[model samples]
Target: MMNRILLSVSGVLLLLVGTATLLQPHAFFATEGITLGNDPGLLSEIRAPGGLLIGCAIAILLGAFRQSMTQTPLILSAIVYGSFGLSRLLSMGLDGLPSSSLIAAAVVELAIGGLCVVFLLRLKPV
Candidate 1:
């Protein structure tokens, strides 16, 4: 179903991105034209969220195949994506424009998050 597809896609993306961010912070941010320094503290800070993302990805992916556990993941998806997208927009306003790739990421995040919300709304109560 559409819900499964959405969760699968989002979860996979989160997993990949989180893995890359956790393992190769420099290379991953480089795609966004960011140059990370060789500071251990900074790298740790950057990597922490990556781990969280991976955790969320696992949960979201699980929800895809579990009919009785749909609602929680939908809520998580909405919050995660919506917050990321909204935060990016906020950054654009506060820090000015970033790379085109980042802008595209924001848009995609918003779209995915919005879709999660739509699917959540359509779910029938048990």
Candidate 2:
């Protein structure tokens, strides 16, 4: 119930972000405070992550609907979000605090990851 809603909402957010990245990498990068220099490989690099994230978003949305049949995708979602948050934490330790927008992103990543973990725990044996 609540878990499913949470998963679906998170999935929707991921889907929107992923889609935006795929369609408008420059705009996405700008919002993230990144500047894609005039490197030949830059677009390729951007598109690669876009494709991967789109795939992940799809899997997460599917998992939201089929929570009983497939916990694996939800598990992967937790891992993905956790990895992003943990990596940001590591960066904070190594590079000091980032700008406020990036800090906000880090917080959102951590909160979403934590929510996913809590939902996983509440899942009953079926």
Residue pairs in candidate 2 whose N, alpha carbon or C atoms collide under 3 angstroms: none
TM-score on alpha carbons, each prediction: 0.97, 0.87
Residue 98, candidate 1: Cα error in Å is 0.7
**What is the Cα root-mean-square deviation between model 2 and the actual structure?**
1.7
In candidate 2, what are the lDDT values of residues 1-126, reduced to their tens digit? 776776787788778877887788888889868888667587887778777778888888887788564466667778877888899999999999988888888888788888888877877766
Candidate 1: deviation at residue 29, Å?
0.7
lDDT string, candidate 1, 50-78, tens digits: 99999999999999999787889888988
RMSD, every candidate, angstroms: 0.7, 1.7
Candidate 2 yields a Cα-based lDDT of: 0.79
Model 2 misplacement above 4 A: none
TM-score of 1: 0.97
Model 2 TM: 0.87
Global lDDT scores for all candidate models: 0.94, 0.79
